[model samples]
Target: MERLQKVIAQAGIASRRKAEELIQQGSVKVNGKVVKELGTKVTRNDRIEVDGIQIEKEEPVYFMLYKPTGVISSVKDEKGRKAVTDFFPMVKERIFPIGRLDYDTSGLLLLTNDGEFANLLMHPRNEIEKVYIAKVKGIIDNEKVRKLQRGVILEDGKTAPAKVKVLGSDRKKETALVEITIHEGRNRQVRRMFEAVGCKVTKLKRERYAFLGLGALRPGDGRALTPHEVKQLRAFASATK
Candidate 1:
């Protein structure tokens, strides 16, 4: 037996967190009976339906996408904008991005039908590092860099310490390439961090997620995660837990 939300998530219907929302919203039924309790568990022999439709378990598929700017990092965009899933036209599984990238920021992103895996990696306790390269409006002085390294205060709260490195700068353009490594997945975190220090991010791209990078793949291209890579990711996440 497994938790109902876990089962729903593994079926590629939604992330475990989203499945809980579905359950609470009275959209989930098991064996023809609405089951709203989050702790409810079900056996393989039981029938699970979400939104009045029975769920089918799909073989989990993992993919790494070289997400491009101007694409939304969602399964589908309500406004008909291009989404990360649009690149996987040949994939039949209901895969979703593990987390997300800003619509205007591009780089390495992971998509998968394994919601449990997604939850594990997105959980803040796991502290998975993500690295970003940002082109800012001005050359960041040592003091501003130190402030970011020490953690800056944002409206939401104080940000975690980030690894900041000034890759280089163009004096004529007054633009500097700053690399930032952070574990927290706050909304527009890199850009916000620079803004908190009086610098504006003109362009940004994520270069790495933990140990994964966008090898030679061009923007909008993707590849499957090798079995070994999946194992390593799971092991690392579990270890951090």
Candidate 2:
């Protein structure tokens, strides 16, 4: 059984914390009874309500693509830039990216038509971990690694703690390759985080999203998500509660 608030949030009613408040306020009804306890448990078949309204379930469709650089994540760009949809002309349905990868970044990206699924994975409050490999200027020192792990101060604000490991360094080119894992989806966050520490990112590529990985898929290639992966993603989302 899952927490009642998690089920409500998974239904796209609100965020997990917001759903908790709704439950406490008698706004959430489970099987027609208003449940106020935060510890209530629920099953997938349970009827959940919010403000006396029922949430309709939508068909879930998930796709993972190895996105190449220079492609916009949107369906169409107003500036005439190429987009991910151009590579999926046969999939005759509307789908959106879970989060995003910058135009100059390449790697794993998840697309789906299910809004709830997207929100559960993409919401910043969920703190779903994302892994990236970045090439930056200079050798990574112990101080830099500690700064990143302890949370670096950026212009926008202090970044959430990141797990950084120096993979290797190029002495001739004066560059370093590091692997960083973070849970926030701020715009260009990985690159900006490096810049905050005085290293300019020359190449950045996402390696993993939650449990999903790029695998052997080449750039501009995609495939349907397996049933096991989808179930694991749902489990991961619910675990955040």
Top-TM-score candidate index: 1
On residues 3-56, what C-alpha lDDT tens digit does candidate 1 reach at each position?
999989887677788999999999999999999999998888888999999997
Q: Candidate 2's error at 144, in angstroms?
A: 0.6
What's the true lDDT of residue 36 in model 2? Answer: 99
Query: Model 2: per-residue lDDT, tens digit, 78-145?
Result: 99998877777887666678888999999999987665677878877678899999999976789989
RMSD of 2: 5.3
C-alpha displacement of 207 in model 2, angstroms?
0.6
Q: Please give each candidate's TM-score.
A: 0.87, 0.77
